[model samples]
Target: MAEDHRHETHPEIVKRLKRAEGHLRSVVEMIEAGRACLDIAQQLHAVEKAIGQAKKTLIQDHLDHCLDDVVGPLARGQRRAIDEFKEITKYL
Candidate 1:
């Protein structure tokens, strides 16, 4: 197997996750401060979107680098497995 692609993108991914974490903390603080619902919801939505985008980037980077190297010339069954795995991630 190829070396994990996470090594390449882990720092960037962690930065995104940390930003989302800060956004989440702000959302909690907003709630505690009795901020307007709209403001709180906006921040929460930003947090969710940030985390979602990070997840997508991580998955895409893995597929592009790690899987391409490890699964070169994939057979029929291997391709099906990859497709199914992708399908399952739609819910994420």
Candidate 2:
């Protein structure tokens, strides 16, 4: 494990989660207020998307930074490229 420098993206991920949390709170309120189903669904979708994007970003950032920290030196020594390693992790 590379000296884990996870703090870099943790703040960003937290911010995203906070936004999702607020949206979820609003959604709960909306439900209690008897808001239209469409309105609730849209807000729920927004919350879902925000969380999903945050997860994807967190994973990609970890793979990009930490994987490079661990594999970059070796790949450089072997004259091999590790971009694919980072790029492919985007699907996770």
Q: How many clashing pairs per prediction, in order?
A: 0, 0
41, model 1: CA deviation in Å?
0.7
Clashing pairs in 2: none
lDDT of 2 by residue, 1-92 (tens): 68755657799899999999999999999999999999999999999999998999888887777676765566354634466666666776
Residue 84 CA displacement from its true place in model 1, Å: 14
Each prediction's whole-model lDDT (CA): 0.84, 0.84
Best candidate, TM-score-wise? 2
lDDT tens digits by residue: candidate 1, 1-92: 89643457778889989999999999999999999999999999999988988898788677766776877788887689886776677666
lDDT of 1 at 44: 91
State the TM-score for model 1: 0.70
All candidates' TM-scores?
Answer: 0.70, 0.76
Judged by whole-model lDDT over C-alpha atoms, candidate 1 comes out at 0.84
Q: How big is the positional error of residue 90 in model 1, measured in Å on the Cα after superposition?
A: 11
The reply for model 2, stretches above 4 Å from the true place, is: 1-5, 76-82
